[model samples]
Target: MGTTRSGEAVGTAFGEYAVRPVRVGEWAAVKALRLAALRDPVADIAFLDTYEKAVAQPDTHWRERTARAAEGADGMRQFIAGTADGTLVGTVTVLVEEPGTTDLAGFPVERRQGHLVGVFVRPGHRGKGLTEVLFEAALEWAWEVGVERVRLIVHPDNARALGFYRKAGFVESGITLPLAGNPDGHELEMVIER
Candidate 1:
């Protein structure tokens, strides 16, 4: 029965972890979690950034990124599942998409919505329902901000993520985006609406 910065009830704890939004000035934790996620085996499809590139980023980059998603930032929100020992084992970020702006691919946003990204959980933290709790926190934030729909893109080959997204109430939107570097590769778009 813990709450986020916005005071939203983030729901029950799972084992040793509790889900909540990352706080301001916690860039180091954010950076560490992201670096860990990039090192995962499915990093190629699960994220657009590479471990090499992420590690090379200066501290300022991480600081600013963290500030943008920190509590009270209107444009982005990042949720993490922190263990009782203070280790963050999982995270998810949501970006607000305005109707007048373009998506990462330059596609026009048709309406104001929330776009989920940077989803991850440490290898040892997989299963046991941590991911679901993280999603619940992230989605709860989206709905609180008045977004009627939320979307995410997953590489078609990422079966694990696809299954998880579906189980979280996101269904295929039938939209596929071509990978930036690999022309033949594509990611499927999924959405969850109230």
Candidate 2:
């Protein structure tokens, strides 16, 4: 329902999808949508975080997360794209990780950076270029927050994810981290420097 970056009247990109922040107190919706993503076929390779753990989190957890991503301090943002019908089609979160501080990847983050995570587009919405729009919004927000670069990691075998990220101007950094939840799960780190 909001205007685009140019302040033009917004219309459906492919007859759906409007990128916006998840509403406050929409924690229930957030929880359910994420559970659905966790059950997706590639979740094993897509996320180091799990649905089982997510669903088990208390209402307060969802509350805190939504609040932080939606309206919290300036370090993070969660953008969800949805249909005109209000069905969430895709989601991603941007975390501004500062230099001299360790990041989620357990690496010594040397410069200010933004990290993208929890990216998912529902089965019905894949291939509509929705993810690219979502990434653009995130990358813009990261730069606004003064990060020098933005980074993401995907499973080594996930060509689809790699393709999307590459098209979005991310390049492999030749760095990898073992998945925290699985012994064999390894992630390919990619980044776009501002």
Among the numbered candidates, top lDDT falls to: 1
Model 2 clashes, total count: 0
Candidate 1 to truth, TM: 0.93
Question: Model 2 TM-score?
Answer: 0.88
In order of appearance, the predictions have TM-scores of: 0.93, 0.88
Q: How would you encode candidate 1's per-residue C-alpha lDDT over 94-118 as one tens digit per residue?
A: 9989898999888999998999999
Clashing pairs in 2: none
- The candidate scoring highest on TM-score is 1
Question: How many pairs collide in each candidate, listed in order?
Answer: 0, 0
Relative to the true structure, how large is the alpha-carbon lDDT of every model? 0.87, 0.81
The reply for model 1, stretches above 4 Å from the true place, is: 1-12, 72-74
What candidate 2 gets wrong by more than 4 Å, as runs, is 1-14, 72-74, 181-185
Model 2, residue 23: distance off in Å is: 2.1
